[model samples]
Target: MMPMTITEIAEAVGGTVTAPFAGEHAGGVPDGEVARSATSDSRLVGEGGVFVAIKGERVDGHDYVAGLGAKGAAAAIVDHAVSDADVTQIVVDDTVEALGALARHNIERRRADAGKPFTLVALTGSVGKTTTKDLLKSLLSTLDETVAPVGSFNNEIGLPLTALTVNADTRYFVAEMGANHVGEIARLTTIAPPDIAIVLKVGVAHLGEFGSVERIAQAKSEIVRGLLPSGTAVLNADDAHVAAMRSIAPADVVWFGIDPAHADEDALTVRELTTDDMDHPSFTLVAANGDTADVRLAIPGAHNAMNALAASTVAHMLGMPLDDIARVLGEQRRISPHRMAVSTVERDGAVFTLIDDSFNANPDSMRAGLDGLARWGAGRKTQPYRVAVLGAMLELGGDEQGLHRSIGAYAAELGLDRIVAVGSATDAEFDALAGALAEGACTAIASRGGTAAVDWVHDADEADRLVTSIASEHPGTVALLKGSHASGLSTLAERWAPADPARR
Candidate 1:
């Protein structure tokens, strides 16, 4: 981050400096100025960095203002509502809002100074933002040094943090944006707004927070609201939540879908992508200008083939070579920790393979992970069982039970050797599915705990304890462990992976 003056930051956000700490003159700092870039916690205060004393929901950042100032934080930007009598402070209506205002100003200044405005790709969706970002970064890297938002840092605070991470050297910035409400994405767009926006697919995500699917779509369209007037959008033509948003997009739009099954031959992007018998889709990607790229996504699931296509579509538009885009995809498909990361465990002579898709989940992603598990475990017939340990899918609003049952039905249709649906809602659905599924091939066990499947049908818990018992006792099975972030299923994925003693 750079250096900026207290007065300059105050003026930009319509804030007032209530007191003075020291002389404001940034010499060695980065964009830590009022009309300039932001500095860091330890940057020279004399080098002019603005200190935002944010009041978090639980912890007040204002409490650390003096400590930060002592560490060379230039000026303190605080809330007018905060009554700090002795120390120097810049008063704003809301400190967090002021920080956002600072981000917008810095973004605008960057635009003004650049000889050419670099393209911004704002990506958002439930299942594939990080994967999409990885794919996009891979394709774009072939063209130039690209900077993408690290991990899932796409929220209000994260967006600014990501923006500050971007400097003049970044030829392209791929901002991964996320939202759980109607107005959240809109607020994020006001900062790292995009030149091209991709709304991947809205699923039963954050239903626990935002209320409904339609409302989720409405929230995601705020990305469209953030695009430049002449910018373009790449959308999932198959998603009703995404498709219905065309009317709201004020820019050019390109539709991408996985349906080669459709009779319409004139689609923007379409390919005959298919998953393996275990459900990993490998397909060639046909780009915009009749150019075809052989896309082999290391990430399983047909949904990711869709994700790869979304990345390639933008790459095609940007003039990336078809071959370069395909070659680097393997390097780019690095799924961050806890997100569909596959590993193995060696317990005695048995091979305990675990597929960890625990970072987050909705029905769409849960299904996708199941497909991946099937693909990775396709040829392992010697493994005693194909087990699925699934936690409850939260926030389906009023239809949580039905949603869980539907997931169970999907599990039943998959013909796994044993299925354990954990948590109350999903357990009920698993029971419903168990009763409905023909007996002979698969067993469906639903419980609020792992003991039910783990201990002759004990109830309580998500996939956590379910996988534990399955792997510990019967080390000869392919296990698919999944749950939302709240359930912390990544730990289980690690437990089954190599060197953990299970797969020894």
Candidate 2:
């Protein structure tokens, strides 16, 4: 958000300034110039920033106009009426949409000037986008100054916001793109379109909006569509569905995989797995040119091995040495507080290891979690139960129920000690698991009250209560908490783990 004018913002979003300068207009203010740097929901406003007041299904931003004035907002972009005592205001049909346009405009201005900037890398998928972003940041940071999408800012608004975060000093920009519908990735790609695009894989994530995995792949492939003509596309060679994404790119394609079977087939791959006594994984890194070296992973799971391979491919394409790339990644931290966060829980008699994967889950990630759990839980004997507080995986659309049922069947087949389910899909899962699973290992329809007919997920307390009740009913468990972003299943895991009661 370089400094711009209020009149320019009005031009940008097709909003009109309802009032001229009512408040004291400063002498140095550019005729209509107003600062529209970042989006803010706070009641307080900055001296020059354009404050967008949005209306939701419930709350209206119109109510906060004067409140914005009280906080010295340079100009208020409003949808409804503003009565009295105002600075400057732009009235629009909707503030949220205005905010989106303003963001897109801001990024386009910077990108149009990217002649002086470095190569851009964009990562997208149902799972591991954040982890891959972190890995790229780690590897690229060794090469030059880097800018990355912070946290989970990978949406329509988040994409532009991340682009705005980049400046002239950044040598590399890593953008994490996320979507749930057909046009989101395409829309996001319009901003921060990458020089190098990484697609983790396609699975049942966000299936609600897009309908099927094929549609999801099409939506994600928009990253390539949005790329510069000479950019590279990096893909998951192991994902059968994602195998075709390379064709979508106008430039070169870089391939990465974790399967040793694919290791010799010319794709860059990482193999040679060894789990430590602590059960964390270490592996060998194999480049596309047939070079190989051993590198220990800070992140757990076979999925992360694939993640490292993807990171390695990007680094190799960017001209990093084979050996140096492995060493830097071998010591970097796994994306924090996400899956494989090692923690311990105290029971009546002994300690049980707890691995928190509560950020979010999809079909691909759920299977990865089960495999990781198998590695961690296989040798522990005192484990009373291998617990999974599985919640409704949203966005599967027509396939939601079937996907949940399949996961349930898979969990039972894995011989997990117990399963606790939330969401409507679990009812389908329960029906699938009941006959195939032993009596004690599987449970279903376990929302707040355990009613069979309820279809939605429970609250944090409810999810936590489910965990407590389950633990009380059967103690000494190793719990794996997984669900979609909206699941709030992290609350359940947090409550069960050792936390300040106030925090809980």
Local accuracy by lDDT, each model: 0.65, 0.67
Model 2 residue 85 lDDT?
Answer: 35
Counting only residues 3 or more apart in sequence or on different chains, how many pairs clash (N, Cα, C under 3 Å) in candidate 1? 37
Mind sharing the TM-score for model 1?
0.80
- In order of appearance, the predictions have TM-scores of 0.80, 0.80
Weakest 10 consecutive residues, lDDT, candidate 2? 447-456
lDDT of 1 by residue, 1-504 (tens): 323466666776788766534334222222433323443232333333455666667877666555443444456667752343233466888767777777776666556656655778898998799888877887887788687876787777777766765555667888898987789898888887788899899887888788877788888888987788887877788887887777877777877787744213323455667665444556776654566766566665667777887887787778777777777764553566666655565544455666667777788887887666655545655534677777656665676666666666566555566666544343564343223222211223332212122211223333445555566777566677776655434455555556542211
Candidate 2 segments exceeding 4 Å error: 18-22, 26-36, 43-48, 67-73, 84-87, 92-94, 112-115, 260-267, 277-279, 289-291, 334-338, 345-352, 377-385, 423-476, 497-504
Q: For candidate 2, list the clashing residue pairs, or say none.
A: 5-33, 5-34, 6-32, 6-34, 207-395, 208-395, 208-396
Model 2, position 497: C-alpha lDDT score: 65
